[model samples]
Target chain A: DAGITQSPRHKVTETGTPVTLRCHQTENHRYMYWYRQDPGHGLRLIHYSYGVKDTDKGEVSDGYSVSRSKTEDFLLTLESATSSQTSVYFCAISDSYGTRGYNEQFFGPGTRLTVL
Target chain B: SQQGEEDPQALSIQEGENATMNCSYKTSINNLQWYRQNSGRGLVHLILIRSNEREKHSGRLRVTLDTSKKSSSLLITASRAADTASYFCAQPGTGTGNQFYFGTGTSLTVIP
Candidate 1:
């Protein structure tokens, strides 16, 4: 596996509450991504970080935020949880993208979050 | 918005039969990749086919890309029960740097 681990593998939080999920990697990869998987929606990117303190929004950035203060850690926070935010969140790491060869992303186990 | 859409949302086949899934996408792409996800697990990278390449194989998995049609297909030969999972195709969005857009996915059930 890709030496990636997600904390709080399963969680249930009430609506309007704050929640944060953590992704820690040991591969020292330059790219880290957060995605949410829902039925009929596949996996939608929530946020991603290219380097320390360098982050960008993805296709489904609403109601979510991310931060990467170190190369090994990436965090996803739901400012105020909602029923629609309930889904399986996955964290991925990649060495490079759009480069000459090598664009495969290694994924972590995943985190299942439920909003009541 | 999702860039890729997979056909036959669900599939069922015998253990020894072959399994094929098709993905159609909008917009240009540099490459297309396939992934598998078991129940309650993260996605596992299966294979990738570049836009310039027509076909590529890895073990029993073969991927074909047709840029003219903007589509791709994945074939798994002699499928086994272990191959039962949801398969998805992904590609980077146009003008988006390092971001991947995934399809809704096809759920496969290989009967033993």
Candidate 2:
């Protein structure tokens, strides 16, 4: 798991409720990412952070927001949970960016969030 | 959008048989990586091959990269039941960003 941990390993929430997932890393990597894994979709990046308080949207950033006040923690927030948001979420960390030719990423155990 | 697509979504083989999975990606990339995911768990890094390299090996795993064909293949020799899991290939996006897109993955079921 690369010393990365996600909070609320499993959660069941109601629709229209707000949910937040936390990712913490001990490696002090430069990059952190949030991704969702669904059937037929391997893993879709929701958001990523390059440094403290530096965040960016990913391909599937809509309906999701992220905050990175510190280097080791990145939070993904769903303003309003929906049934479609019920999926396994994973957190990943990398020592360097892919464009820099360092592309190895380590993933967390994942958090299973279910919306009713 | 996904940068890579894996062929043969599912595979089944005997313990002693070999399994090969292929991945095709769009656009140029600096490197490609393979990962394995067990049911209900996070992925584990397997091997990484750079664009400048043709083939790379690690233990029983062999990976080949064909930049000319925009494809790569992962071959697992002497399969085992414990090897049953989903395998995915990932590559950095074409743009200058750091995002890495993953393929749909191939589910391998190794029979004991």
Error of 1 at A68 (Å): 0.6
lDDT of 1 by residue, A19-56 (tens): 99999999998889999988888888889888899999
| Model 1 residue A39 lDDT score | 86
Interface RMSD of each: 1.7, 1.5
When only the first chain is scored, the TM-scores of the models are 0.95, 0.94
- What lDDT tens digits, residue by residue, belong to model 1 across residues B12-111? 9999999999999887888999999998888889988888899999999999999999999999999999999999999876533467888889999999
Q: Which stretches of candidate 1 lie over 4 Å from their true place?
A: A97-100, B94-97
lDDT, residue A92, model 2: 95
lDDT of 2 by residue, A1-116 (tens): 88999998999999999999999999999888999999888898899888888888888888899999988899999999999999999999888654655767899999999999
Give the Cα error of residue A69 in candidate 2, in Å: 0.5
Give the runs in model 2 whose Cα sits over 4 Å from its true position: A97-101, B94-97
lDDT of all predictions, in order shown?
0.90, 0.91
